[model samples]
Target: MRTLHWFRNDLRLQDNPALLAACQQGEVLPVFILDTDEPVRSALGGASRAWLHQSLTALDASLNNNLVMLKGSAQTLIPDLCARYQIEAVTWNRGYEPWTIQRDSGLKAALKANGLSVTSYNGALLFEPWDTVKKDGYPYRVYTPFYKHCMANLATRTPGVLNTARIQMVPHGEQAGLESLALRPKVAWDEAMLMDWTPGEQGAQGRLQHFLATGMGDYREGRDFPAKRSVSGLSAHLHFGEISPHQILASVRAESPADDNQTHFIKELVWREFSYNLLYHFPTLQEKNLQAKFDHFPWETDETFLKAWQTGQTGYPIVDAGMRELRQTGSMHNRVRMIVASFLIKNLKLHWHHGERWFWDCLVDADLASNSASWQWCAGSGADAAPYFRIFNPITQGQRFDPDGAYTRRYVPELKRMPSKYLYEPWACPVEISRAAGVVIGKDYPAPIVEVKASREAALAAFSEMKRRAES
Candidate 1:
């Protein structure tokens, strides 16, 4: 039997159920299509595109250059390829995004109608969004309950499938190569990203092993500190499907004893699952407020403030550092991500969409479900969102989490010599200390764009108005 395996997010070979199924059946032709028909909102971001370019190159090399790269509409391309190759069956790992779900369903129906076998396996997530639901059969809205249920009902994980069968390649007649996708940027803006990341299955496995050895023991506490290496740094790999969550979970279970740090790490992974659950059930998660009262909330539209926040001149040391770090590295510390997000929504009074869109374009680990849910969580407009009154104070957050100022100073170098006393709040630095530190508040580093206390009050007032309007 001749089968074609379509590679979407699941890019790796090992433990890939669909790919393994294809290989075991008979001669398997692996193919990846960069679907151009994706809606603007669902389209791959700049950083994600760059990562995909490198990831696809790695995958192709793993296949011994047998991976067929194609572009344009998958709806048109897949069927055409199946017919051309005389493929007996089509297999793919499922994607949970609303667009992808719709596309796959339609494509699957079309393929079956034409008397071809079509099968899709769950490869992206540990649990299908529908599997871990409330007793009432409705999807979970709050995370704590969802986490508890998932943990209590944790199933025995199957080992990753090892494909010992030789992968047979289809004759490459005229498919365009990887470069034809133009996933890399026209300018050399990706040099820093290239230096920091190794985008492939090997790289993903290496990261997991490294995190297990060095980070997992202290993960619970050290993860909060931006300067620490407690994070797995496998977010991009997971987002790209270079590694499966099952593999990570199994590895963690086998490698570490059940401890607070291990439990916390598992909970963090479950949070990603929660985001997908929300996305699967609530398709408008990326656009509309999950909590409807936010519809009446007053959001300020100030291009000046937006630009300041974007360029990391917010004058809030921690916020600036996080934003600058995102620009330079295409990633940000999770704790700092919260700080920056809170500053944008609560302090600047900007809509969370701004932050979500920016992160979508900038972050390498920018998963749609997590990005949208997190931005909404920060804005207090999502399910299990933070309370509107619980705004993050950038100064205090910096003082607490990034206490040593190492993470801040690395991104915001003007504050390199500023004493810890005023590292987070440079505007409050003494004149003598400022001169000694060779940094000027308004000149060298920006002064705080908005006063924290006043902005907090304004945000509360806006929230009250939203409630008032919603009630009326």
Candidate 2:
């Protein structure tokens, strides 16, 4: 019996339901098809492209270098491979994104019509997006009830074990090797990401173990502080399906009782689930406002401001630091992600999609659901979104989270010499103090792009006007 396992988001061998099911039947041939044709399936951002190349390389190495890689639309490539390999059954993990769900559904129908068996399993998320819903059977718009429903309803399953010794490897037949994908950036822009991240199952497992050993202790208190280095940093791994959320949950449960810190970490995972729910319910989330009133809210676009924000020259230390960290490491602290996102959407009053697009291109952990939902949350145009008036004041956010300036200084080297007192609000320092710090505002460090108080008020007024117009 020959079975084909199609690898999509779920990249790892162990604990992968689809892969394990395929292995159970007979000889397992693992195949990965790069689908980039559909309109909803946009081109991979530069950072994600780079990470994918490394991840695929690592995955092939793990598969004893027998993993078959193909390029083109999965609709054509999948049937072609099945015919070429004389495969009888095909199995794969489900991708919950709207585009993926549609694509996979059509492929499964086509494959089954040809007398080949097709099976799809939940490999990425703890529960399928369609499984959880409100009492009336409508999808959840708010996260609280959705998370509570999931917790009470969804039972945790033990991670699956893979017996690689019993597995038979199919020979790679006319497959495009990892290098043929050209996922790496043409220019040398990823030196720091290369140093900071390891992209496969080994790297993912190592990161999880290290976080459990060291960072988990202070995760609750220090997670909000960018300088603490207490975050699990498992986001990219999660996004790439190098590791499953179940594995992380099981590891935490096995380590100790669910303490406050452990519970908080679990909440964060649930947040990811909530984002998927939003994406599943709202297919046009990435392109339009979830809250329809935001459609009428006037948003100004300044290319100069957008460029400054993108390049980490926003003149606000914390915002710049977060952006620079994103540029350097292909990741940013969660707290800083919120702060910078708020600065962009509220302070600049540009559309949230602009910020969403930039993060999609930059962050290694960028997922269609999470990125879109998060930007909407920050902009107050999402389901269960923050109130539009709750604009984040970057300086206060910095002083609160990045106090002692360690995180800011580490990323924004220009502010390395400033005093801790004047770290966040560098413009407030005396001329003599600025001179002593060897930094001149508006020259070495640019002044604030927009005044915080004024921007907040302007954002509030705009939101109010939009609300009024909607009511009328």
Candidate 3:
């Protein structure tokens, strides 16, 4: 019997349950479909598409160039492929996004109705979102209980299978190549990204091993400092399913002794799971505020400020650094991500949607669930969100996290010569010091876009008005 394995997020051959299942049966046909018509939030951003192009290339090579690439609606294409190839069964790893869920459901039904055996496996997440819920059977609305619950009931997973030797490729004539998908950027903007990342299973495994050996020891404290190498840097790899969470978890548990750093890393992984849980339970997570009270909040519509924020001209060094890093490297440090997001939503009084959309386009790890949930969390409009009043002070955040200014200066090179005392707040540098440093605030580097203290007061006032209006 011929089986078809539709590759979605699970891009790797190692530890891919659905792919393994397909191989176990008979000759397997591996296929990938690029459905560009997905909803705006679900669609692949430019950075993500570029990464996808590389990832698919790597996956095709791993399959001995047997991977088939298709474009257009999967609803129409999968059945056609199955019919053409005389495939008796179809298999795939599950997707958690709302659009994918709906699409997969319809496609599954259509395939089964046509007398094709279809099976979907939980390959993306360690545990299905529905598996861990409140005792009352409702979904979790907070992180602590969910984490405690997950930790208390940690389940053992079967080891990832390597079935390459058994995977007999179903021979077919040449189809469209990976380049025909047009996933790479049309311009030359991706040079830095190419230098920064290796998008494949081997790369993901190498990253995980390197992090375990070096980064995991100090991950808890050093992860916040952007200059430190404590981060795993596996987010883009994970986003593309080049590696599995189970693989990471198993490695962490086996290789390292239990410690605060290890625990913190595991908790961070759980946070990803939590984001997926929220997305799964609340389908409108991408579009609407999970907390309805935010609907009454006064959000500003200032294109100039939004554009400034997008271009890293906000004049706040740390925030600008983060944004610039995103544009340059297709990734940003996590701590800086929160600082930049807070500056955008609270200080600028812009809607979180603006930041969300921007990150969706720029981040190599631009996941639908995590991106939406994180932006809303920063805006204080999401599940377990920071309180609206708890705004981040970008200046203090910079001094605290990037104290030596190494991380900030690397991206915001205009302020490279500024004194450490005045690095984060270049606008405050004395005239003599500014001249000595060969930097002029408002000329070479922008002045602070909005006064932080005044913006905090204005944001509080707006939040108060929103509360009053919501109550009334």
User: Model 1's lDDT to the true fold?
Assistant: 0.92
Write the candidate numbers in order of decreasing TM-score: 3, 1, 2
Cα lDDT tens digits for candidate 1, 1-472: 9999999999899878899888888888889999998999989999889899999999999988888899899999999989998998999999999999999999999999999999999988878898989989999999999999999877648656765446776676755989888899999798787687899999999999999999999999899999996999999999999999888999999999899999999999999999999999999999999999999999999999999999999999999999999988899999999999999999989999999999999999999999999999999999999998899999899999988999999999999999999998888888999999999889999988999999999999999999999999
Model 3 gets an lDDT of 0.92
Which regions of candidate 3 fall more than 4 Å away from where they truly are?
A: none
Span of ten consecutive residues with least summed lDDT in model 2: 36-45
Per-candidate TM-score against the hidden true structure: 0.98, 0.98, 0.99
Instruction: State the lDDT at 2 in candidate 2.
Output: 87
The TM-score of predicted model 1 comes to: 0.98
Query: Relative to the true structure, how large is the alpha-carbon lDDT of every model?
Result: 0.92, 0.89, 0.92
Q: In model 2, what are the clashing residue pairs, if there are any?
A: none
Residue-wise C-alpha lDDT for candidate 2, range 1-472, written one tens digit per residue: 7899999888898899999998899898899888866564455688988888889989988888889887788899889888988989999998877778888899999999999999999888987888888888899999899989988975677999899778787665565788777788888687668688899888999999999999999999989998999999999999989999999989987885578898889989999999998899888888889989888897888888898899999889999999999989999999999999999988998888889889999889889999999999989999999998888899999999988899999999988999999999899999998988889999999998999999889988888888888888
lDDT of 1 at 372: 94
